[model samples]
Target: MGSCIICGTPVEGRICDSHQEDVVFEFRGNEASQLTPGRFYSGAVDGYADFGVFVDLAPGVTGLLHRSELDRRLESLDWEPGDTVFVQVKNVRDNGNIDLGWSIRQSERDFRGALVQDADGDHEDDESDESDDAEAEVETPTVRHGSASRDESDESNESNESGKSNESNESGKSNESNESRHQRDEAEPEPSADRERVEIGTLGDRVGEEVRIEGEVVSAQQTGGPTVFEVRDETGVVDAAAFVEAGVRAYPDVDVGSVVRLDGEIELRHNEIQVETEALVSLEGDDADTVQSRLDDALRGRARPDEVTPLADHDAIVSVGTQLQDAAEEIRRAVFESRPIIVRHTTTADGYVAGAAVERAVLPLIREEHAKSDAEYHYFDRRPLEEAVYGMDAATNDVTRMLQDRDRHGEKLPLVLLVGTGATVESSDGLDLLSIYGAKRVVADAAAVDAEIEESTDVLVSPVLADADASDLSTGALVANLAAAVNDDVRSDLRHLPAVSYWEDAPQAYLDAASDAGYDETYVRELREAIALEAYYQSYEDKRELITDLLFDNGVTPDGDGENAGNLASHVSEQFRLKLDAEVETARANLESREADGVDFAVLDTDAYTHRFDFPPTALLLDELHRREREGDTFVTIGVAMDELYLRSTADVDLRAVAEAAREHAPEAGITAVGIREGRIEFLSGRREQVKEAVVEAVAEQLA
Candidate 1:
């Protein structure tokens, strides 16, 4: 028996049952069944698949590291064939399939005790160099000088002189390369050979000519014809394709995040610039450092803007300016890194206005950062949510799509930006699901804050979080300032969006800003109505071009001359007014009035009085009705649908306390508080009458 290496407790072998996971084991056994479940195993990357990667603990014995098990993302991994990696053996299936999970300690040096388990016995791994075979794995950022092994700066390290005339040119016999390398080298010289390096940003001018460029390989995708390496330098990024045989990965050593020198002919294919690679070599030591330093400097310089200054003078905005600046930096950095951004917002007028403002700002920056034309569309996405709460159903759908994209197209995990839709206790489960995969989540609540959401999100920008009053702060105004911070080039396009968001009680600062930008109060109202109408129609699609025309297209030209400036807004707004007026008139005829504790309540059974399937949704209809029936100082509107009850009041009404009171009064009503911000409550349809009366009494008791 041997004592546990971790805690010094007596054990059967090197580790106690309690501390078995404390040590990392290098499995030297040939059989997959020999791998103990729940033990960390040192393995080598065998290959990749759509679902996961194949990791071999020993030759001919491999385990599957499913993408779901990864902490970050599968595409984010820079592992190549034969690179040593660490993973925990989760399970051994009956079919001899070994399931592997992500290990926090990837390197052997991170583990406290590194052990080796083989057929003979268990002992400490003397040297972790088993995968240091003659495989061309780019494991480290150090140059290889006439060396075949991944870790070696082997015997007689000098330039080859087998066919040269000078004495310095000739050297002793070295470890020769395999037939594949010999054949590949015969077609093209090594990339380490002396050549003039050029910037990728200048490649557009040097098209149809051969050039050498040094950069980090951001992506390496194996296509049916060739393997395309998206190499990014300090200046810009470009795709360089290397071909071996059909459907085979060329330059298997090069991978994502590898600093390399590549030589190729710049050519235009499908109207996009591509490099037909002749030679590519991984750079190391000083060479890699020079390229990496330049890239880092460029990223910082390009991504970071000056400290944010609020456009309009508002105390709340001034208080949250730091969070706004941080959100802007995160967005710009994601764009620079070529990471996809998914924007989620409610399908309301404020949500659409805010989401569209950010879209306008980011599209221009995407075009400037990436050379490809579709990079703007591919990288920036805007998704509208039916409800303000980002629930488990939405999070599940997002993760599934992200995983599929990573597995199929080798795309990076998206930066999910929740605008005006992720600041509530209801959104915690959704954020937790995203946090599990290390997916970056930014919650731009703008109006309010919740501690539950704040605890889960990576970046949260809410006025209340900064100890500022959000009573007058609209979500649109907050996000417009944030969008301007992201890309100040499109600042002019966002000048009028904030004023258009407010239906009433708009800050005069925003109104004057809109008036100065050529939008009068009437024009702003028309634009708001038009967007609101369109927002509900699709309610899901971004409607990019149409929204842009209404908000930015007319004002785009220098003269800003367009007779049709108000044509679309006037046309769409007419329908918005007609549909809304019709819904209101129908609801007014069936309104039920009740007075309790010196408070007046306007109750409407939305199911009977309102066109359920038509425009001006139940909530919006109730809000409009409440506004017109403000005869009394203490007035409230309670809209009762089949199974849901919505409350809107000029006075403060605590939704949670009201729900509790109703539950106490009508215990079998099964009343539940849906959301505080939404002022929503749910009840059993069978107890709808009881729930409606109890809720009205509860609200009157508080407002009295």
Candidate 2:
């Protein structure tokens, strides 16, 4: 039988060989076990070593107890390197290296002492006997270690005792050296600060310094003080103040659960850390939110150079913003750090108010960008626009009904935009007119444009056309300021188009948007070079000499008369091609570049998150309403689909009142404006403006 390396005893029968490589395994240090791959251990030792000792954790599981694992103390002679050790398995290597650990340094000390006393000098029995009572009399010692700082003497002892080996008269001492390590099992430690209190100095000594101190609240009395309070950190407590405080005044009224930091001097009273007469703040607030704010304030005050350093690892951070400028900055920072950021908008009133203001004020600045683009802009709406269309149901007569009703021939449609009258311009000047019209119309969605374009049939003027390059400069590119100045629809339209500027005389701010686009460099170069040269232009006599010069040199001149339909068609085709090419290039580059390593950048599919909304828990009250309807106990008994009910769940409206209103309005055919999520219905007015108000008021009244 192979000898157990740990206990120096021979093994019997089939040796249990655990074939787990790199897996942590624990066993008694005294067990007879052979060294094998895939097992690690930690334990008490029975001997000392110059290098390290062999610890046999179990049958076929042995690890080295290196001298580097010994504890502090020049006088420590309890354990030897090769003797039986009470250990914990950490990791087992393939090449037979076993990482071991000990819960307490005393274990190793006791084990080493046992081995030293047992070692035989010429007389083997003397070594073996060692007055058996001596082994029985040794008591196991206990110790604790944590992140908290320890006594300087303890560290000094460890450093000094690292040299030297315990010599024995029996067999020559083992070769392994020893080092000290302390480990603790996962368990809540009992509080022991009451037994002995340590005096750690005042703020000056503790500000940048770290010390362990325990204190008791003598009195948590509050005063009508400023919006500042004192709370304790590990080192000490400090006064935490804030800008807002009218609500916090009385201290005795505060709850006992409130824990505050002390700011100034630490007065030792009755052998406990205590402080008095400092600023006080209430930790108690409405809920967790108040606590979180207090804690955040404390953390901000207590932040130190060391704590700020990430502990080698941590979870990623997250930030949120609804404004484009703020979002862009946040995104840029996240990208720089190579950290993933989950963004969400804070649906507070500030965001909506600011968004509405931005929508109204910024679009006007870039009026030229939306000229020709078939893009659509979406402005911030206090309520969903879809709801507004359904709110216009007050009218009774046919004409009024037609105007008020969202449903026309069972087709639930929304409001029609009242576009300004078309301008009359010659075919040559038609370019400017088309540019102006397109700039205004393009930012609107394809659906909105299609609807509006179909209703109007009269043509007051022929189409004015410009070369492809001039087309963008003359009419396209609605700036944020200019777009925001017009109606909400105009703002929505501007969001859909790219900003472009052709003439040097164009708005400087509008040109900035074009320059921001990736293609601006190419456009700028062509315009400058062509404008300086005479050969690029066919005639200076042409009313559009400057336009001709810019276009011909830039290869933007059409194949037919500048006003011809063929020219307009060609220009549109060229613009489409250029846009398509740019989009394709961007896609190809994204696909070709390597994404961040080890990070899966897949977008979370939202199909599952939607299921929660689809299946809401049945409230007893709602069930009662449904039962009443079934029994014909309720009026009108309007029937809504499952999704509508689900959408209404998040709404402020009362379900019972909505049901009652629907029942009452069903006969009169009072309109029910379905939300955007509804597939069959489209409201006429802005959903947010009209429908949301009615639904909220009606539901809230009923619920109340």
Candidate 3:
């Protein structure tokens, strides 16, 4: 029998069963079922897939390391095929499928002890065997009456030596003793001369050494084994895990955003630096104020830019600088507080491009702020709205989901960001409901916003209010600039988004920006067409990964004509043209031209002439038709439906003015400008005849 290396208890092996999981093992087993779950093992990288990496645990025994299990992005891993790595056996399914988990310790030296494991059982190291054999060679002596006195001296000396030996076995300290030590450390006052306080950014240099730090608690979460508190100092943020007891809460009084002084030993967990917190105490009164002051000073110096610089030299962009700063600050605050950010954008090419730019900029910051791999999905969501309006329907869905998340998972309510929408009076009801629930709202659009919307949102970015022609800008261009202000690291990646937003004539500034970022006019057109095609197919789902692949991935060959050399835009654009051209041909054949009150008009019964539940909705179809059929005359295309009417004009038609005329002409029709920017108006179905005649007359008068 051998003594347990951890507790000095006699056992069949070197370590007791209770400590089996604490030591790393080298597996000699051939079958997958022989591996022990929750035990670390040495493995080698096999290959990578879109979902995860394949790891070979033993000869002919491979397991999957899913991307969700990784602490960092799968693409960022610098592993090559056959490179040795360490992982934990999370499970071995009945079908012989092995599941691996990430391990912080990639080297054997990081583990406390190493054991050789096999199909039958585990074995002690060679050094333990040698020591056991030597101990067995010692002989025992018999006691006599006269020799009792002399034996007493030897017995006393031996007892003293045994006690000294036990004291030297610090690694085998009992759990009760460790708990007592932690209690004592917690009760002790702040150190005066033992160790100087260090900045979190410099923790890498002081790893494995005890240090003191003063910071604010950003977040506190309990795992099955420890309570991890994310602490942030002026320099950086770090997670300090405290393990007083399994599944027990630590530092019950220290809550989020509270200033505290902590003492801990720096350690690496999951390939990231973390602190093993030995002691933590809340800083109160003057101490708290001092820490807050220091943090605020540092944040002011580094957190945001001094002034908002416009991406392009435009007067409207310059005028909205203050609002842009507010929006950027709000987004940054949400990230720091661990609050989720929900982006609601219209389901159009321009809207998707704008939303995608924000996604790209914010995801990296989310990943950096939180340790969990799924934090990106939890903290950032990009949802597509069917129309450019945040009405009661969309607001209800968002509030319901957020309320559920808050009740079920104890998550904070998310910050709702309306992109390319929610900046008009039509969406005021939705904004008011969100405000009543204390949810913050921000609007980024290129449309003419209502004056009331300015008061409804925390930050509003609308170029039309600043005297710049909204027609010359796209939502993508404005939000792209906002995204740059949110995170400067992604500025270069977003430079091409503005040009992609324009379907026909792009402003020279945006075109120049795209060109500077290496996208020419043809490439820009291809990207626009490809995105438009994809947007139409999955109108509801925000094809985030696929869109990212098409726009950002340079190595992807969508055409498959060359070895990773063909552009994705080239392939998707072909499909876009084929589908769009067919629809255009059908629309042209059914078009009817008429002149009323000396005004030329092209009218189509959209419900009867076009595919209702298919690609190119009424707004997009009319936009495309006007571009093709309008021949410089004062022309308007009225797409009539059962309950609604869509008006598109070659000349600049004031939708609000037309709506006023229609309302006066047919007061009972309830005509309203629902989509003024799109040159669209809605009419009640009950007064279809009255509304249709009024709309036709209104168009003629406006054209005249």
**Best-fitting candidate, measured by TM-score?**
1
Which pairs clash inside model 1? none
Q: Against the correct fold, how does model 1 do in TM-score?
A: 0.72
Q: Candidate 1 lDDT, tens digit per residue, 1-704?
A: 87654444557787777546655776788888787999888889999997999999998889999977764446557899999888999999998999999875554323434577998767754433332232335322221211121112111111110111111101322222355445544444457466899999899898878889999876666442345567888777777766543223456667777999988788775467867787788889998999889888998988777877666777888898889988898898888877889999988788998899889888887787676655776678899988878999889999997875564345678889999888888789998999997778988876536866788888899987887888888889999999999988777778888899888888988998889889999999998888888888867777776677677754222212323334778788889999999889988889998899988888999999888887887777877898888675689999999999999888878888899999988999989987566678999999999999999889988888
Better of 2 and 3 by TM-score: 3
Please give the RMSD to the true structure for each candidate, in Å.
15.9, 29.7, 12.8
Off by over 4 Å in 2: 1-146, 149-208, 211-259, 262-511, 514-704
Provide the global lDDT of candidate 1 against the true structure: 0.75
Cα lDDT tens digits, model 3, 1-704, are 87654345678966677556545777888999889999888888999887898999889899999976775557668899999888999999999999999875564423434567788678744554554354335332111111221122121111000001121133655423555446534553443446667998788788778889998886565332344567888777776765433223455556667798988777664466777676677888998999899888877665565677666665666767777788888887777666789999988889889899899889998887664445677679899998888999999999998875553233567899999899998899998888888788999998757767987888787875566666677888888888889888888888888889988888888888889988888888888888887888767777776688777764165332335656678788888888778887898899888888877788887878888788777777887888888876687888888777888877777778888999999998889988765666788888887887898898888888
Ten residues in sequence with the least summed lDDT for candidate 2: 312-321
Q: Which segments of model 3 are wrong by more than 4 Å?
A: 1-195, 336-338, 366-375, 403-412, 554-565, 663-670, 683-690
Clashes of each: 0, 122, 0
- Model 3: how far residue 247 lies from native, Å: 3.3
RMSD of 3: 12.8
Better of 1 and 2 by TM-score: 1
